[model samples]
Target: MSEFKQLYKPLLDGANWQQPDQLGIEGTEIGHWLLEQDSLSRRFQRHCEAFTVSLIEQVKISHAALTNDERALIGDEDCLLRKVVLQGDGQPWVFARTLIPISTLTGQERDLEQLGEMPLGFRVFTDRSGRRDALVVADVGTDTQPLWARRSRLWINEKPLLVAELFLAQAPIYGKEKQC
Candidate 1:
């Protein structure tokens, strides 16, 4: 396992994922956020005066060490794992984790490894070659304080990157409801 995985085992281990529609959240506001096809960072900025991406850690993990779900999506290749928290008005709103295969970092794409304090969603949206796959939702927090998350495969220059973003309790995407 990567250091990030070891450090965040509770969040990443044994996660349960389901289609948003199957979970009956497709018509809700949080559902809208979960199913957004555009840049989540842009949508977040529209709801908050200030938005920031705070890096937690970035590490490289061997394919043999990745979680089963991660391995299934990213295939059997060594990858770079990046963890960050997206904040709105100084309050943490989302925890994002990205997996980029080492082979994907070629030419201009190597810039992805050096995006300190920059949101991955912004980069994906700005890049014309970026394409988003279908999303899956999960409850990663707890019963009392559910942290809803969305995960998807992003293709940039025909390379695959996995992105998972868990909505924090203070996220405005939760709106007036406590659960999606």
Candidate 2:
């Protein structure tokens, strides 16, 4: 198991599995502010909040082993495991891991369009038997247009780990003529 896994295991086993809303640092402004607070409970709450934001913004998933359907599903929403590593004075701290679900797109075309604009890396593969699969990596400026046009599924990864998947389904192409 990786260091993060080891650090996070205890939190996962605990009962208070709430998502964080922020990330607390040791000496920065947010950190100082949180430290000055009188209560340890409030301090911990602030720390979790800061950690949450960092997880969403910095944590990345590499998608090298996912089906096309999985890729499509991730493209439609932000569902994935959010993680963060914090360096302390004596040791490194791994925050709890939370599986966040992405919102699904309602219409086929609309969702496809949305996927096309994602700034994450995407890849498509086909097996000899004609099975299709795709992988997605969460990074800055990764494109999703090719996936949409080809109707490929999506997966995301980080540190050689699969974090999320997207699935696509067929839907009727609606036109202006159907309106009464």
Provide the lDDT at 98 for model 1.
Answer: 88
Off by over 4 Å in 2: 16-78, 104-180
Compare the candidates by TM-score and give the number of the best one.
1
Q: Top lDDT: which candidate number?
A: 1
Relative to the true structure, how large is the alpha-carbon lDDT of every model?
Answer: 0.82, 0.26
Instruction: State the weakest 10-residue window (summed lDDT) of model 2.
Output: 166-175
lDDT of 2 by residue, 1-180 (tens): 255455333333322211112222345532332223232212333333231112323332344433344444444334444443332222232232322233322222123223221222221111122222332211111154210101112222211112221111110111111211
Quality of model 2 by C-alpha lDDT = 0.26
TM-score for each of the candidates: 0.89, 0.23
Model 2 error, position 89 (Å): 5.2
Residue 32 of model 1: what lDDT?
Answer: 84
